[model samples]
Target: MGAVSEPLIQWFELNRRLLPFRQEPSAYHIWVSEIMLQQTRVSAALPYYERFVAELPDPAALAACDPDKLRKLWQGLGYYSRVANMQKAAQIVCRQYGGQLPADYAALRALPGIGDYTAGAIASIAFGIPAPAVDGNVLRVFARLDNSSADITKPAAKREFTARVLEEMPKERPGPYNEALMELGALVCLPNGAPKCEVCPLAAQCKGRAAGRAEQLPVKTAKPEKTLVPVTAALITGPQGVLLQRRPSKGLLAGLWQPFAFEGTAMTQPELDAALRTIGLCVQWQAPLQSTRHVFTHRIWQISGFCGTAAGPAPEGCVWASRAELNGEYAVPSAFAGIMRQWRPE
Candidate 1:
C-alpha cells in the first residue's frame, strides 16, 4: 500500500478515458462490457457496447430480446456464445430474481454466462466491493510489477496474482483502484514486446526494471498451430427461396442456417456436378463466388462459395429460408458476417 504514490493515482485520475460502461456503472453494464472485451480490442468493442446497451437497457429488456437479434448484434464480435449466454443469464435473473442482477458473487457466477472474470468486474465496479477485477490486463500489470517469470497462461499463476491484488485493493475506491491496475497494463505495460516506463507510475517498483526482461516477465506457453480445413458452401436457390440447412443444435455454428456445403474437400468438377444435381433441381453452375477464406482459432477453412440456380421444387430436409427470414429472424455465425454484405434481398 505504501509503495503506490500520489503520482500513480494522479496519472490515472487525469488520464483515464471516461468509458461508456463506466459512466453510470451498473452490474449489468459492467458484466456486458467485460464479456465483450474478452479477446477484443476496446476500439472494436465501443460500437457493440453502445448498440447493445441501447437495445437491451435492463434485465427485462434483455430478457425480452429475441436470442437471434442478440446474436445478430453480436455478429462479427466473435466468441458469440458469451453474448448468447448473457441473454440466457439475464432471462434467468428476470425469472428467478425479478429482472435484477444479483448482488452476491456466488449468485452472479452461477448465472448461465457469467464467469469468474465477469463476476469480479460486476462485483467491484457496480457494487464497490473490495474484490479485484483481475483480467489479462491486470495480470500483465502485476507480472511486470513483481518482475517474475510466471507463465500467465497457467491457472495457478493467475490465481496467485489475483489473490495478491485482492489483498491490496483499496476498499474505499475499489473501482478506481481496479481501473488503475488495468489501465497501467493497457497503456504503460504493453504486451507484444514494448513498454513505456518513462510515464509509468510504478516505475520504481517494477521488478522487470531491475531484471532487464520487462517485456518477458509475464510469460505464456507457445500457441498450438491451427489445423487447415477445407469446406464448400452452396448457393442452392429456387422460387421456394435459397435452400439452407440448419446446423445441428450443438457444435460449431450450432443452430444457425448454412447452405449445403461439401465439407472436407474441394469438389472435383465431376463431384461438383453431382452435388449440384443432388439438390433436386439443376442449372448451370456459375464459377464459384471465389473461395472464401475463414479462420478460427483451432481450425482454418478454405471454403468455396458457389453460385447455382435450381429449376425444380426445393429438396426435402433443406429449409428454404427467404430474404425476409434472413434479416433478423435467424441467427448466423460471424463467419457469414462478411458474406452477407454481398447478398441481395432479391
Candidate 2:
C-alpha cells in the first residue's frame, strides 16, 4: 500500500456512482461498459449498455446474434467498428474459452479490440488480478500527482503512468483501488475546466496542485484538423416508403443503411434527375431539405439532399422501406439523421 491508495479507495467507496456495471462486475459487463465508455459519457451510454446486456447476456449470445440486429443494438453508439470487433472477440471466446472471457490479462489483450487498458480493467475489476488499468483518467491523475508535463498521447507516457499506477496498487483489493483511481479522476480531477482538488482525496499529495499547475500537467498533442466531405443524398420516395441504400461492407459506417448519396456539395435538380435515371428511377424533384453536418473522428460530412417521389421499381443496390421497416429492421447510422428525419414517412 502507498500513501494515496488507502485514502483514494476510501473516497471511492463513499462517493462512487451506482453504475449498472459496478453493481454487477462480471467480465462481460466490464468489457462492454469499458468499450462503450471509451468515447462516450456515462449518462449517454447507460441506456445502450443496459439494452445491450439485456438482449445479449453472454459471450455466446453476442457471438450468435444476427449481424443486422447487432448493428441495430449499437445503432446510436458511433464507432461501429468497436462493436464489430467485440463480436469477433465473442466468437473467439465461444470457440476457445467456452464462451466466457479469459481471466488472464494476456489472453484478454489477445482478443479483438481489447487493448492494455481494457485488459487491465477486466483483469483487475472482474477477476481480482493486480493489474493497472491506466486510461486517460488515470494518466491525468498520475501526471498531476507527479506534476510531470509529459505528453500523455505518447506510448512512453502511458507506459510510465502504468508503472506508477502499479506501484501504488493495493494487491489485496486491486479492484476497488483501480476503480477508485478512475473515479477520482472522473469526479474530482476533471480533464476540462478546473479540477475540484479541494474534495479530491489525493489533493494533498498532488504535486501539480502544490506547483499551481494541476490543470496543465497531462499535456497532449494536438490532433490534425478533420477533413470536410461534402455529400449529396437523394431521398427518393414512392408508394413503398423511403429509398435507403446499403453502404459497402467495409469502410466508414460499414454495412449500414443511408439515402442514395453522391460525393459533391451541390447537385442541380437536372443532375440529380439524371443520376436517378442512371440508377433506373425517374424522380420528380420536390424541394431541398435542411442541410446538416455530422462529425466523425477524422472527417466531417457536410450533407445536403433533396426529397422526391419515384414511381418505379426499386434500384439494384437500394430498397424501399416503409417507416415501420426502417424503424424495426434496418440499422441506419446517425450520419444521415437530418435527411431521414425530413424525408421519413409521417
Candidate 3:
C-alpha cells in the first residue's frame, strides 16, 4: 500500500457507519455481506443485511431454511439467482466445511455462491489473506488513477485491477489497508461526474485528476432501454372459491400463485374475463378493485385487477381455493399481496 492506505484507514476508523455487519462480525456475516454488497451499496444493503442476518443467523440456519422462506426473505431484491445460490453455498458450508467459511481463496471461490470478487473479499476481510477484492469501487479507483480509457465492465480490466491490488497489499495490516482503498472509492469516488479529489487520498496520484478527466476516464458501454409489460388480473369470487392461477416456472413471478391473469395490451375487465374463459372459466360481472404498477429490472407491470362472481363451478382454469391459500401457501408477488391486504377476504 502507498501513503494512501494509512490515512484512509484512519479516516474509515473515524467515519464508518455503525452497521450490524460491522459489529462482532463472523466469517458468515462477512461472507453474506460481501455477497449482498455485490453491485449494491452499503446504504441500500443495510436493511436487507439486517433482515437476512436476523432470519438466517448462521450457515447451519441458512442451510436449513425452506426455499420458499428464503425467497420470501429476498422477495424484492432482484437477481434472485444470487440469493438462491447463497442458500446452496450455505448447505455446502454446513455439510462439507462444518459451517465455517473456507479460508483459502481458491477453496472459498469454489463455493456455490462465491465468485472471484466474493472469494477475495471473504479471504482477505474475514481470514486475513492479503487478497485484493476488486469490485466496481476498486475498478473505478484503478481507472481514474491510471486514467485508463478501457471499459471497467470488461473482464480484462477486472483481472488487471485485482492482480495490481494483490501486488500492492501492504506487508503488515493488509486487511484494513485493502478494505480502506475500497471504502474510498465507494464513499468518495463518485461514479458519474467529478470525484471529490479535494478529499480523496489518491487525488495527487490520480492521472485522471491530473489531466482533468476524472469524470470520463473509466468509460462504460451504453445500457439498453427497459421494456414495459402490461398484465390483467381477476379477483374472482363465488361460493366455490376465488380463482387462482399458477405462474409459469420461468420469468417474472415464476412459481407464484395468483388470481386468473394474463399479459396483454389492455387490462379491461371483459378482456380479463375472456382470458379466464380460455382456461375454461365463464365470468360474471366483477367490479374493478385496483390499478397499480410494479417495476422490475427490465420490465414494468401496469396491472389492473377486479373482483367478480363465477357463473357456476369454478372453470378448469381456476385453482379452487380460499383466500387463506393465497396468503399462506402461495408466494404471491408483493404487488399482488399488497392488493390482497386491502381486500377484506370474503
Candidate 4:
C-alpha cells in the first residue's frame, strides 16, 4: 500500500456523505449515479437519481424504456446524450451480458459513454476490482501529492497520473482506497484554488503543500471562447395552449421541444410578422417578455422572447400543448425556461 492508503481510507470512512448510491452500492446504482454526476452536482442529481432508479431499476428495464419517456425522466438535467448513450449500453448489456453490467474493466469500458474514469469507478467501487478511477478530483489529489505542475487536460498527463494512482492502489481494498481518493479531493483537496490542506488526512505526505503550491499544481489549458448566438423565440398561444417545435434529432438540445424560434439579430414587428407568416401562423404580438441567456459548452444563446396569440391551427411540424400537457407530456429543454415561464393562456 502507498502512503495515502491507510489514513485516506480512514478519513473517508469517518467523513463520507450518506448518499443514496452509497447506501445501495449495486452495479446499476453506481453506474446510474456516475453518469448523472458527470456535469451535475450531487445535491442536484439526488432527486433525479432516485426517480430514475425507481422508474427503471435494472438494465433490462432501461433497455426497454421509451426514448421520449426516458428524456422526460431526464428533463432539466442537460446533456441528453448521456441518458441516450446509457440506454444504448443497457440494450447491449441485455442482449450480450444477460442484463447485468460486466465486472471486467475492459468490458465496462466498451460500453457507450463509459470512459476510462467511469469504467474504473463502476469496476472498482461495485465489483471490488483494483482499478484507478482518475477523474478531475483524483487528478487534483495526485498533482498535489507529488507537487507536479502538469496540465491535467492533456492526455499524456492523465496517463502518467493514472499510472501513479494504480501504483498507490491497495489491491485488497481497492474499492475503498479509490473512493477515499475521490472523496478527499471533493471535500478537502478541492479545485479552483480552494483546497483545505489543514484538515486533509494526507497533508503530511502532500508535496504540493510542502512546496506551497497545492492550489497551482494541477494546471489546465484555457478553453476557447464561446460563440455567441442571438435568438428570437415566439411563445405563441391560442385555445390549444402553447406552440412548441421539436428540435432536430442531432445537435444542441437534440430531439427536445422548445418554443418556435429562429437564430438572428433582433427583429422588428414587420419582420417578426413576416417570419410567423412563413410558418403558416398569423400571430398578433402582445407584450415583450424578459430576455435571457443560456450557456452551453461551445456556444452562448442570447434570447429575446415575445408573447403572442395565434389565429389558426398548429403550424407544420409543430404542436400545441396545454400547460398540463406541457408539465406532464412534453420534455421541454431548460434553455427555454425563461420564455416558457412567461407563457399565458389565451
Candidate 5:
C-alpha cells in the first residue's frame, strides 16, 4: 500500500453513504447494486435495487425469472441490456458455479456484461480480493491526483491507472480501499469543473490541485454527436384502456413494453390511423400532446405524443392495459414518461 491508502480509507469510513447494499456486503447484493449503479445515480437506483433484490434475491432466482417479468422489473432504468446481460450471467452462475458469483476476477469477468471495472468491483468489494475498480470517477480522481495527461478513453490509460490504483490498494482491506476511492471520486473529486478539493482528504497530495489544473488533468476524446431521431408515441385509449406494444425481443429497448410508437418521423393523423389499420384496428384521432425529448448514449428521441380512442381486439403481441394494469402489471420505460403523464395513469 502507498501513502493514499490510510487517509482515503479513513475518509470513506467517515463519509460513505448509508446505502442499503452497503449494510449487507454480500456477493449477490454487491453484484446487483454495482450493475444498477452503472450510468445511474445511487439515489435513482435505490428503489429499483430494493425491488429487484426483493424479487430476485439470488442468482438462481434471477436465472429462473421470466423474461417479461425481468424486463418489467428493470423498466424505468435505461440501458435495458444491463439487466438482460445480468440475467445471462445469473444463469451461468446458477448452472456452473452453484448460484455464487465467482470470487476470482477472471471468472467473474467472463460472465455476460461483466467487464474489467465491474469484475474488479465484485471481486474486491464482495470477496475481499486485491483489485482495482477504475470507472470514470476513479479516472478523474487519479488523473488529478497524479496530474496525468493521458487520454482517459484509451485502453492503455485505463491499464496504467489500474496499476497505479493497485499500488495504493491495501492488501488486507481491499474492499474498503476500493470503495473509498470510488466514494471520494463521486463525492469530493467531482468532474465537469466542480471538484470539492477543500474537503478532499487527498488534496494535500494531489498534483493537479497543486498545479492548479485539476479539471484539465483527465483528458478524453470528444464524444460522438447524438443523432436526433423523431418519434411518435400513440396513447390509444378505448373501453379496455390504453394500447401498449411489446418491443421486439432484441434491439434497442428490447423486450420492454411501450405505448404504440413509431421511430423515424412524427406520424400525421392519417398515417397514425393507417398504422392502426395495419395492426387490424382503427383509432379516432383525439388531440396531439406536447413534444419532449429522451436522450440516450448515441441518440436523442424527439418525441411527439398524442392521445386517442380505439376499438376492437388488440393486434397480435400487444395488450390493452387499463390504468390499473399500467400501474400494476406493466413496466413502462421512463422514455414514455411524457406521454404517460398526459394520460396521468396514476
Candidate 6:
C-alpha cells in the first residue's frame, strides 16, 4: 500500500455505511447488490435489494424461478435485462458451481451481467481477493487526486486508472481500500461541483485541489440527446377488468405488461375509434386523462391517455386483468404510472 491506498483504507474503516449486504457479507449477496446498483443509486436500490434477496434467497431459487415472476420481482427497477441475465447466470451456477457464485474474479466475469468492475467488487469485497473495482465514483476520486484531464469515459482512460488502482491497492486490505475510494467519491468528492475537501481524507495530497481543478479534472464526452417518441396509451376497461397487453419478447421492457398503446401524439376521434375497433372494443371515449412523460436511456415516451368502456371478449395476445390482479399480480412498469393515476374506470 502507498500514500493513496493506505490512508483510504483507514478512512473507510471509520466511515463505511452499514449496508444490508455488508452486514452479513457473502458472494451471492455482493454479486446481487452490485448488479442492482449498476446505473442505480444506493438509496433507490435498498428496498429492491431487500425484496429480491428475501424472495430469491439463493442461486437454486433464482435458477428455478418462473421468468414472469422474476420480472415481477424486478419491476420498477428498469434495466430489466440485468435481472434476465442474472437468471441465466444463476442457472449456470447451479449446474456448474453447485449453486454458488464463483470466488475467482475471472470466473465471476464469465457470468452474464458480471463485468470486470462487478467481478472485482465480488472478489475483493466478498471473497477478500486482491482486486480493484473501479466504478464512476472511483474514477472521479482518482481523477481529482491525480489532477488528470483524461476523458474518463474512454476505455483507455479506464484501463490506465485501473492500473493505478491495482498498483496502489494494498494486497492485504484491498476491500477496505476499494470501498473507501468509492465512498469518498460518492460523499465527499462529489461530481457536480466543488468537492468537500475540508472533510476528505486525501485533501492534503490531492493534486487537483492543489491546482484548483478538483471539480474539473475528470472530463467526459457528452452523450447524445434522447429522442422524443410520441405515444397514446389507452385504458380500455370492461366489466371483467382493464385490458393489458404483453410486450414482444425481445426489446425495450421485454416481457412486461402495459396498457393498449398506439404510436403518435393524442389521437383524433376517428383514430381512437379505429384503434378501439381493432381490439374488438366498440364504445364511446370518456373524459381525456392527463398526458405524461417517461424517459428511457435513449428515448422518451410522451404519453397521452383516455379511459373508455369496452364490451367484448379479451383480444388474443392480451389479458383483461381485474383490478385485484392489476394491484396484486401485474407488474406494470412506471412508464404507465401517470396514466394509471388519472384512470377512472367506468
The 0-to-1 C-alpha lDDT of every candidate, in the order given, reads 0.76, 0.91, 0.74, 0.91, 0.89, 0.87
Task: In model 6, state the lDDT of residue 211.
Answer: 96
Which regions of candidate 5 deviate over 4 angstroms?
344-346
Error of 5 at 139 (Å): 0.5
Deviation from native of the Cα of residue 145 in model 1, angstroms = 0.8
Candidate 6 local lDDT, 98-139, one digit each (tens): 999988999999999899999999899888899999999999
- The residue-by-residue lDDT of candidate 4 on 251-324, one tens digit each, is 77778899988875777667777988886789888888689999888889999867888756787778899999
Q: Model 6: residues >4 Å from true position, as ranges?
A: 264-266
Worst 10 residues of 6 by lDDT: 337-346
Residue 103 lDDT (model 3): 82
lDDT tens per residue, model 5, 1-346? 5699999988999999999999988888998999999989999999999999999999999999998889888888889999999999999998899889998999999999998888999999999899789999899999999999999999999998999999888899999989998999889999888899999999999999999999776889989999999998888888888889988889999878888889998888788878778868777777997888999999999999678887788899899999888887887888888888887442
For 1-346, candidate 3 gives per-residue lDDT tens digits of 5565666678778766677766856788988888887757778888888999998989899999887777767665555667778988989888889888778988888988788778877788778887778877888887888888888777877777777776667757666766777788877887887588888877777788999889886786776677777777677767755666676756666665676666757667766767666767777764777777776677777777777777466554346666665545555666566555545545
- Residue pairs clashing in model 5 are none
Tell me the TM-score of each prediction against the true structure: 0.89, 0.97, 0.83, 0.97, 0.97, 0.96
Better of 3 and 4 by TM-score: 4
Which regions of candidate 3 are displaced past 4 Å?
39-41, 236-246, 249-253, 257-260, 264-268, 278-282, 285-295, 302-330, 334-346
lDDT of candidate 6 at residue 143, scale 0 to 100: 90
Instruction: Judging by lDDT, tell me the better candidate of 1 and 2.
Output: 2
lDDT of 4: 0.91
RMSD of model 3, in Å? 3.5
Error of 3 at 54 (Å): 2.1
Off by over 4 Å in 2: 344-346
Which stretches of model 4 miss by more than 4 angstroms?
A: none
On a 0 to 1 TM-score scale, where does candidate 5 land against the true structure?
A: 0.97
Prediction-by-prediction clash tally: 1, 0, 0, 0, 0, 0
RMSD of each: 2.6, 1.2, 3.5, 1.2, 1.5, 1.5
